[model samples]
Target: MRQRTGRLLGPLLVLLLVGAGPDGSGETVSLDGDRPGERLDVTLTRVVDPAGRADSERLVAVELRLENTGSVPYEDSPAPAAHLLDTAGQRFTGTAAATGAGPSLPDTVTLAPGDSASGFVTFRVPAGAGLAAVQFALDAGLGDDVGHWSLS
Candidate 1:
Protein backbone atom coordinates (compact mmCIF):
# COMPACT_ATOMS: atom_id res chain seq x y z
CA MET A 1 0.00 0.00 0.00
CA ARG A 2 2.81 2.43 0.82
CA GLN A 3 4.58 1.74 -2.51
CA ARG A 4 1.37 2.31 -4.43
CA THR A 5 0.79 5.62 -2.62
CA GLY A 6 4.31 6.75 -3.40
CA ARG A 7 3.84 5.97 -7.07
CA LEU A 8 0.62 7.98 -7.16
CA LEU A 9 2.22 10.93 -5.43
CA GLY A 10 4.62 11.56 -8.29
CA PRO A 11 1.94 12.06 -10.87
CA LEU A 12 -0.24 13.99 -8.46
CA LEU A 13 2.50 16.50 -7.79
CA VAL A 14 3.01 17.06 -11.50
CA LEU A 15 -0.69 17.65 -12.00
CA LEU A 16 -0.75 20.19 -9.21
CA LEU A 17 2.12 22.10 -10.74
CA VAL A 18 0.70 21.93 -14.25
CA GLY A 19 -2.62 23.32 -13.06
CA ALA A 20 -1.01 26.49 -11.78
CA GLY A 21 -0.91 29.57 -14.02
CA PRO A 22 -1.10 33.35 -13.92
CA ASP A 23 -3.73 34.39 -11.42
CA GLY A 24 -6.77 36.21 -12.73
CA SER A 25 -9.86 37.96 -11.50
CA GLY A 26 -12.50 35.75 -9.98
CA GLU A 27 -14.11 35.43 -13.38
CA THR A 28 -11.11 34.07 -15.28
CA VAL A 29 -7.45 33.08 -15.34
CA SER A 30 -4.63 32.81 -17.88
CA LEU A 31 -3.72 29.37 -19.19
CA ASP A 32 -0.75 27.52 -20.61
CA GLY A 33 -1.53 25.21 -23.51
CA ASP A 34 0.84 22.37 -24.39
CA ARG A 35 0.67 19.26 -26.54
CA PRO A 36 3.37 16.74 -25.83
CA GLY A 37 6.45 18.23 -27.54
CA GLU A 38 5.03 21.70 -28.09
CA ARG A 39 4.15 24.21 -25.38
CA LEU A 40 2.84 27.76 -25.41
CA ASP A 41 2.43 30.18 -22.55
CA VAL A 42 -0.24 32.79 -23.15
CA THR A 43 -0.92 35.71 -20.87
CA LEU A 44 -3.48 38.44 -21.38
CA THR A 45 -1.77 41.63 -20.35
CA ARG A 46 -4.58 44.09 -20.97
CA VAL A 47 -7.45 45.18 -23.21
CA VAL A 48 -7.48 48.60 -24.83
CA ASP A 49 -10.63 50.44 -25.75
CA PRO A 50 -11.18 52.67 -28.71
CA ALA A 51 -10.33 56.33 -28.37
CA GLY A 52 -13.53 57.68 -29.85
CA ARG A 53 -16.80 56.72 -31.47
CA ALA A 54 -15.41 57.02 -34.97
CA ASP A 55 -12.61 54.56 -34.25
CA SER A 56 -14.69 52.19 -32.15
CA GLU A 57 -15.30 49.77 -34.95
CA ARG A 58 -11.62 49.10 -35.62
CA LEU A 59 -9.74 50.16 -32.52
CA VAL A 60 -10.18 47.60 -29.76
CA ALA A 61 -7.00 45.62 -29.13
CA VAL A 62 -5.86 42.76 -26.93
CA GLU A 63 -2.27 42.74 -25.73
CA LEU A 64 -0.62 39.44 -25.01
CA ARG A 65 2.71 37.74 -24.43
CA LEU A 66 3.21 34.52 -26.35
CA GLU A 67 6.05 32.27 -25.31
CA ASN A 68 7.38 29.23 -27.09
CA THR A 69 8.50 26.89 -24.41
CA GLY A 70 8.93 23.95 -26.68
CA SER A 71 12.11 22.70 -28.26
CA VAL A 72 10.83 23.58 -31.72
CA PRO A 73 10.58 26.86 -33.55
CA TYR A 74 7.25 28.68 -33.78
CA GLU A 75 6.74 30.14 -37.22
CA ASP A 76 4.98 33.46 -37.40
CA SER A 77 3.22 34.87 -40.44
CA PRO A 78 2.14 38.29 -41.58
CA ALA A 79 -1.47 37.32 -41.75
CA PRO A 80 -3.75 37.57 -38.73
CA ALA A 81 -3.45 34.53 -36.52
CA ALA A 82 -5.76 35.36 -33.68
CA HIS A 83 -9.39 36.13 -32.93
CA LEU A 84 -11.32 37.71 -30.14
CA LEU A 85 -14.40 35.97 -28.81
CA ASP A 86 -17.03 38.13 -27.23
CA THR A 87 -19.47 37.24 -24.49
CA ALA A 88 -22.21 36.45 -26.97
CA GLY A 89 -20.03 33.97 -28.86
CA GLN A 90 -19.24 36.43 -31.60
CA ARG A 91 -15.82 36.06 -33.17
CA PHE A 92 -13.77 39.15 -34.04
CA THR A 93 -10.97 38.22 -36.36
CA GLY A 94 -7.62 39.97 -36.13
CA THR A 95 -7.16 43.14 -38.15
CA ALA A 96 -4.05 43.56 -40.25
CA ALA A 97 -4.25 47.33 -40.50
CA ALA A 98 -4.73 47.76 -36.78
CA THR A 99 -1.40 46.13 -36.02
CA GLY A 100 0.46 49.16 -37.32
CA ALA A 101 -0.78 51.28 -34.43
CA GLY A 102 1.03 49.38 -31.71
CA PRO A 103 3.82 47.01 -30.86
CA SER A 104 3.16 43.86 -32.83
CA LEU A 105 4.56 40.46 -33.47
CA PRO A 106 7.00 40.17 -36.33
CA ASP A 107 5.89 39.29 -39.83
CA THR A 108 7.76 36.04 -39.54
CA VAL A 109 9.10 35.18 -36.12
CA THR A 110 10.76 31.83 -35.62
CA LEU A 111 11.18 31.15 -31.97
CA ALA A 112 13.92 28.93 -30.69
CA PRO A 113 13.58 26.84 -27.59
CA GLY A 114 12.57 28.96 -24.58
CA ASP A 115 12.06 32.03 -26.77
CA SER A 116 9.04 34.30 -26.62
CA ALA A 117 7.34 36.98 -28.66
CA SER A 118 4.93 39.67 -27.49
CA GLY A 119 2.36 41.53 -29.59
CA PHE A 120 -1.05 43.10 -29.93
CA VAL A 121 -3.93 41.56 -31.86
CA THR A 122 -6.52 44.10 -32.81
CA PHE A 123 -10.09 43.43 -33.80
CA ARG A 124 -13.05 45.22 -35.25
CA VAL A 125 -15.71 44.95 -32.62
CA PRO A 126 -19.21 46.24 -32.31
CA ALA A 127 -19.97 49.11 -29.96
CA GLY A 128 -21.29 46.84 -27.22
CA ALA A 129 -19.09 43.84 -27.75
CA GLY A 130 -17.65 42.34 -24.58
CA LEU A 131 -14.52 40.30 -25.15
CA ALA A 132 -14.20 37.28 -22.91
CA ALA A 133 -11.51 35.22 -24.54
CA VAL A 134 -8.86 34.98 -27.26
CA GLN A 135 -7.74 32.22 -29.61
CA PHE A 136 -4.34 32.27 -31.24
CA ALA A 137 -2.63 30.03 -33.76
CA LEU A 138 0.92 30.13 -34.93
CA ASP A 139 0.11 28.73 -38.31
CA ALA A 140 -3.29 30.30 -38.84
CA GLY A 141 -5.27 27.05 -38.56
CA LEU A 142 -2.79 24.88 -40.41
CA GLY A 143 -1.21 23.54 -37.23
CA ASP A 144 -2.65 21.25 -34.61
CA ASP A 145 -1.93 23.44 -31.59
CA VAL A 146 -3.54 26.70 -30.63
CA GLY A 147 -3.17 28.85 -27.56
CA HIS A 148 -6.17 30.13 -25.66
CA TRP A 149 -6.49 32.84 -23.03
CA SER A 150 -9.55 33.66 -20.88
CA LEU A 151 -10.43 37.20 -19.80
CA SER A 152 -13.88 36.80 -18.32
Candidate 2:
Protein backbone atom coordinates (compact mmCIF):
# COMPACT_ATOMS: atom_id res chain seq x y z
CA MET A 1 0.00 0.00 0.00
CA ARG A 2 1.37 3.44 -0.90
CA GLN A 3 2.05 5.53 2.19
CA ARG A 4 -0.27 8.48 2.73
CA THR A 5 1.40 11.76 3.72
CA GLY A 6 -0.14 15.23 3.81
CA ARG A 7 0.67 18.77 5.02
CA LEU A 8 -1.47 20.68 7.46
CA LEU A 9 -2.74 23.96 6.04
CA GLY A 10 0.95 23.70 4.86
CA PRO A 11 4.37 22.85 6.47
CA LEU A 12 2.38 21.57 9.44
CA LEU A 13 1.91 18.30 7.62
CA VAL A 14 0.94 15.06 9.39
CA LEU A 15 3.58 12.36 9.21
CA LEU A 16 2.22 8.83 9.68
CA LEU A 17 4.77 6.05 9.55
CA VAL A 18 3.64 2.91 7.79
CA GLY A 19 2.20 0.06 9.87
CA ALA A 20 1.23 2.95 12.21
CA GLY A 21 -0.82 0.51 14.21
CA PRO A 22 -2.75 -2.71 13.74
CA ASP A 23 -2.58 -3.45 10.04
CA GLY A 24 -4.53 -0.70 8.26
CA SER A 25 -8.11 -1.58 7.32
CA GLY A 26 -10.52 -0.42 4.67
CA GLU A 27 -9.67 0.35 1.02
CA THR A 28 -7.69 3.33 -0.22
CA VAL A 29 -9.48 6.20 -1.91
CA SER A 30 -8.75 6.11 -5.64
CA LEU A 31 -9.63 9.83 -5.72
CA ASP A 32 -11.47 9.00 -8.92
CA GLY A 33 -14.58 7.10 -7.79
CA ASP A 34 -15.73 3.98 -6.03
CA ARG A 35 -14.47 0.54 -7.06
CA PRO A 36 -16.39 -1.17 -9.78
CA GLY A 37 -19.37 -3.36 -8.92
CA GLU A 38 -19.13 -2.16 -5.30
CA ARG A 39 -22.23 -1.03 -3.51
CA LEU A 40 -20.54 0.30 -0.35
CA ASP A 41 -18.99 3.74 0.06
CA VAL A 42 -17.32 5.48 3.00
CA THR A 43 -16.88 9.21 3.43
CA LEU A 44 -15.03 11.42 5.92
CA THR A 45 -16.19 14.98 6.48
CA ARG A 46 -14.75 17.82 8.58
CA VAL A 47 -15.42 21.45 9.49
CA VAL A 48 -12.94 23.96 10.97
CA ASP A 49 -14.00 27.23 12.61
CA PRO A 50 -11.45 29.56 14.24
CA ALA A 51 -12.78 31.64 17.11
CA GLY A 52 -11.22 34.04 19.60
CA ARG A 53 -11.08 32.77 23.16
CA ALA A 54 -9.42 35.64 25.06
CA ASP A 55 -8.33 39.12 24.06
CA SER A 56 -5.01 37.77 22.78
CA GLU A 57 -5.89 34.11 22.38
CA ARG A 58 -7.85 32.14 19.79
CA LEU A 59 -9.19 28.59 19.33
CA VAL A 60 -10.26 26.62 16.32
CA ALA A 61 -13.45 24.59 16.66
CA VAL A 62 -13.07 21.48 14.51
CA GLU A 63 -15.94 19.06 13.89
CA LEU A 64 -15.24 15.68 12.30
CA ARG A 65 -17.99 13.52 10.86
CA LEU A 66 -17.58 9.95 9.60
CA GLU A 67 -20.27 8.04 7.79
CA ASN A 68 -20.61 4.72 5.92
CA THR A 69 -22.49 6.08 2.94
CA GLY A 70 -22.54 2.71 1.22
CA SER A 71 -24.53 -0.37 2.01
CA VAL A 72 -21.48 -2.28 3.23
CA PRO A 73 -19.47 -2.00 6.43
CA TYR A 74 -15.67 -1.70 6.85
CA GLU A 75 -13.13 -0.43 9.33
CA ASP A 76 -12.32 3.28 8.85
CA SER A 77 -8.95 5.05 9.20
CA PRO A 78 -8.16 7.30 12.16
CA ALA A 79 -8.21 11.08 11.85
CA PRO A 80 -5.01 13.14 11.88
CA ALA A 81 -3.83 15.87 14.28
CA ALA A 82 -4.68 19.50 13.60
CA HIS A 83 -2.04 22.20 14.13
CA LEU A 84 -1.61 25.98 13.82
CA LEU A 85 1.47 27.85 12.57
CA ASP A 86 2.56 31.50 12.61
CA THR A 87 4.52 33.65 10.15
CA ALA A 88 7.86 33.42 12.00
CA GLY A 89 7.97 29.59 11.85
CA GLN A 90 6.59 29.11 15.35
CA ARG A 91 4.19 26.46 16.60
CA PHE A 92 0.84 28.04 17.63
CA THR A 93 1.09 26.91 21.24
CA GLY A 94 3.03 28.78 23.95
CA THR A 95 6.55 29.40 22.65
CA ALA A 96 8.72 32.52 22.76
CA ALA A 97 6.56 34.85 20.69
CA ALA A 98 3.17 33.10 21.07
CA THR A 99 1.73 31.70 24.30
CA GLY A 100 -0.73 28.84 24.02
CA ALA A 101 -1.25 25.15 23.21
CA GLY A 102 -0.33 24.56 19.55
CA PRO A 103 -2.75 21.99 18.10
CA SER A 104 -2.76 19.38 20.82
CA LEU A 105 -6.52 18.89 20.88
CA PRO A 106 -8.02 16.22 23.12
CA ASP A 107 -9.61 13.72 20.79
CA THR A 108 -10.26 10.08 21.78
CA VAL A 109 -12.81 8.80 19.32
CA THR A 110 -13.38 6.06 16.71
CA LEU A 111 -16.41 5.63 14.46
CA ALA A 112 -17.93 2.34 13.48
CA PRO A 113 -18.59 1.42 9.85
CA GLY A 114 -21.83 3.39 10.24
CA ASP A 115 -21.50 5.47 13.39
CA SER A 116 -20.26 9.09 13.60
CA ALA A 117 -18.39 11.17 16.23
CA SER A 118 -17.05 14.70 16.84
CA GLY A 119 -13.92 16.21 18.46
CA PHE A 120 -12.32 19.63 19.23
CA VAL A 121 -8.80 21.16 19.03
CA THR A 122 -7.95 24.15 21.27
CA PHE A 123 -5.26 26.59 20.04
CA ARG A 124 -3.94 29.27 22.40
CA VAL A 125 -2.52 32.36 20.71
CA PRO A 126 -0.65 35.12 22.52
CA ALA A 127 -1.40 38.82 22.32
CA GLY A 128 -0.07 40.65 19.25
CA ALA A 129 1.03 37.39 17.64
CA GLY A 130 1.10 37.29 13.89
CA LEU A 131 -0.62 34.11 12.74
CA ALA A 132 -0.38 33.13 9.11
CA ALA A 133 -2.41 29.89 8.72
CA VAL A 134 -3.78 26.78 10.43
CA GLN A 135 -2.90 23.27 9.31
CA PHE A 136 -4.38 19.75 9.67
CA ALA A 137 -2.96 16.27 9.05
CA LEU A 138 -3.17 12.75 10.40
CA ASP A 139 -0.24 12.08 12.71
CA ALA A 140 -0.40 8.30 12.35
CA GLY A 141 1.97 8.47 15.31
CA LEU A 142 -1.17 8.73 17.44
CA GLY A 143 -1.84 5.11 16.46
CA ASP A 144 -5.19 5.87 14.82
CA ASP A 145 -6.71 6.51 11.39
CA VAL A 146 -9.26 9.30 11.97
CA GLY A 147 -6.84 12.17 11.29
CA HIS A 148 -9.85 13.70 9.53
CA TRP A 149 -7.68 15.06 6.69
CA SER A 150 -10.32 16.91 4.73
CA LEU A 151 -10.54 20.42 6.21
CA SER A 152 -7.06 21.24 4.90
Q: Name the candidate that leads on lDDT.
A: 1
**Per-model TM against the reference:** 0.63, 0.38
Mind giving the per-residue lDDT tens digits that candidate 2 earns over 1-152?
22344434455656553332121223232111132221212222222334446665655433333343334432322223444455566654211121132232223434344554434455565655555433332322232222212221
lDDT by residue (1-152, candidate 1, tens digit) is 00001112434622111221322212122222233455555555666666224354646666667677766666665237677778899977775444444786555667676887766667777888776666665455333344455555
Please list the residue runs of candidate 2 whose C-alpha ends up more than 4 Å from where it truly belongs after superposition.
1-50, 54-56, 66-80, 93-106, 139-152
Q: Which stretches of candidate 1 lie over 4 Å from their true place?
A: 1-36, 51-58, 99-101, 142-145
Which pairs clash in model 1? none
lDDT of 1 at 35: 39
Q: Note the Cα lDDT for every prediction shown.
A: 0.54, 0.35
Among the numbered candidates, top TM-score falls to 1
Candidate 1 lDDT (Cα, 0 to 1):
0.54
